[model samples]
Target chain A: MEDPLGKLMPSEVEFIAEDAPITITPNFQAGVFLFLKERVGPFKPQRPMEVPMWLAVSLRRRDKCVIHVPEWLSVDALTTKLEEEKMQQKQFVHMPAHFQEISSILFDVASQDVPNSEECRQLIQAIVDVRTAKIRQGGLDDMKDSLAIQLNNVTQMEITSIRQFACHAMDAFNRLSSV
Target chain B: MSYFDIDDILMQEERLPCVASIDVIKMGSLDPSSATPYLRKGSKVDLPLWLIKSYREKNGEDIFEVDPPKFLGPKYLDMLRADATVINLQSWCSHFFSFAITYLTLFQDGDLATTIQDSFGHRYLVILDISQNAVQDDTSEKTRNLDQLERQLFHAGLQDDRAQQQWRRRQAHRILPWAGAPRRDAFELGHLTKRPKLSFS
Candidate 1:
């Protein structure tokens, strides 16, 4: 009855969150040694260095760095991408599992640096709303013909919402099959 | 003659379904002639049907009584019906069904047995529908493949003997005296060991 899929999804999200890249411009002209077995640098003021999103956020929090928003995260690009995805109806954009969380963090901490931040946030929210509604409708449609359910592109958070029900259902099926 | 063997069914019927009649203070004192020890009050103890029948004939008292399995009652079934996502449903169902099936074999109460069967069947179908709904909304095959790979990696991590052994070795190294003091010993013998004299020239 152990759900391998349920357990793995969160770790995958964490891995993606840690690995996502972000750029930061240091305010101070001093080297900050990281305990992660590497040196960040004797930072030059206004020179941007690319690091993992987590390290960038930490540096930004400590007032040590100003984040440079990635080009893909700009309002126009994301809005266009969101629109395209909605129109295609067959494929989701290639996004990290923790995209929403990372975007929220960027929106919260580095709003001034990001171009058209409010518009970007609105587009992302609208896309999320559309996707969630579609997911619910798909679930209802699949229930009509029990044999045709095929799961794909489900976010980790979405899986977590229904994990308990899925696990119990699978366990019941296993018991019935064994008998 | 049915799907189950007749001799097996007959043997199951020969066993008595009885709860203890009274509190047995001393196990050795009561029923000294019998091989088995006396049971405490409220404990269910099955005896041979012939022994219970003959004892009832002599005493004219109903000493042995049927104690229906707990899951055979309405409470558990109602809970299962109300909440499919109830915690520990897997283990609970397995335990209840095993006991209920054994109880059904011993006592030929058709109505109770049929009820249990129907309850299990209904719950199973409900679970199936829930699972179907959970997986219906996926939008891409690539994410599904990634999910499969992630599951494989997670299981591999659980079963990786080399990683487990390396972790144990690292823990053992941490506990050793030399591992902790190696840097400290080198630091003490280094050039910085000498104290610098403070003087304004």
Candidate 2:
């Protein structure tokens, strides 16, 4: 099998026993956790950058975008807490998006107060525009991996903006990405 | 002397050496969907020495092949070493909690636990739950599967003596059962309820 990294084929085959397939429940709102099932195949041939497909949709619903972290439970009680949590709707305890999407959101939020903020906004919108095109070119089925990649790219772009926008959103972006 | 009681173990150098061994250590997300394949067949994995050393500054060796060892890997053993350094029990407790968070899992149902454990003793619990869908409320298979994963973590917390003691202590004072006696305490209370009849014996 070809190495997933694809840069330099590793000398050793290093065959890790393939793990069983993973199944997930989809969250319709987040524009991120739309995939109901996730399999760990070799990284896709050409990955998408980290711009979220649902950025437009999430932005439209930003007013409703709320961060609700569940209360911390006892050490031993975590499993129980998570199980109880699993029983309920998957709440967006962290910022209301995946790691990459959260970074982009923070980036946009920071730029909202910058010089030529409208221009910055357009730059971000352009990135989102490119992402939306990619999504449309490859239907939802083929877009999952690409979406993850684009989301990562958007996150990287946000990281670079930390110097430009020293805001809570930037602070959060740093923390979330580091985590 | 704070929240966790490691004084006795720390006092005994040989019994609880400066570095005791760890038999099993599993790490990663606790969500069943995220924890599935790793926990599949309840598989337990070894922690590399470099990673274990990242947690503690001490000379150590991989003892996975050694008989009569303390643990399956060094991470759990390092957790034991860290317990001795903390003065506060809450800190110690939290340390253990983090260990559980990163290493162990919670499996929910008794039957599923039995089924999975029966198939793979300690190795089956490593499955990862990567579910991207929203977790639901119904007692459907999805919920049951996820619950089983939680139950595995709960039990994993009980695998070690430190974790076991904390688990028991916490359960002794759990927040539930508003209007009734807890079963564990009830059993102990039942024995006390027979007071005054002890004179004959």
How many Å off is the CA of B119 in candidate 2? Answer: 4.2
Runs in model 2 lying further than 4 Å from the true structure? A1-105, A113-179, B1-127, B130-132, B135-139, B145-201
- For model 2, how does the per-residue alpha-carbon lDDT over B1-201 read when each residue is reduced to its tens digit? 233434312211111112224332353332234343232333333433323433443435532231211431354344434442222223223222222222222112343223222222121122112121213423234323222223333222222222223322323223233356545565466744422210100
Docking quality category of candidate 2 according to DockQ thresholds: incorrect
Best by DockQ: 1
TM-score of each: 0.45, 0.15
DockQ-derived CAPRI band for the predicted complex in model 1: incorrect
Over A1-179, each residue of candidate 2 has an lDDT whose tens digit, in order, gives: 11123211011110110111112222222322222133121222233223222332232244322211112212233334334433433221121112223323333433332344454434434443444333223322222222221222222222222111112212222222221
Query: RMSD to the native, candidate 2?
Result: 29.2
* Top TM-score hit: 1
Tally clashing residue pairs in candidate 1.
1
Tell me the TM-score of model 2. 0.15
Q: After superposition, how far is residue A58 of candidate 1 from its true place, in Å?
A: 2.2
Model 1: how far is B114 from its true place, Å?
14
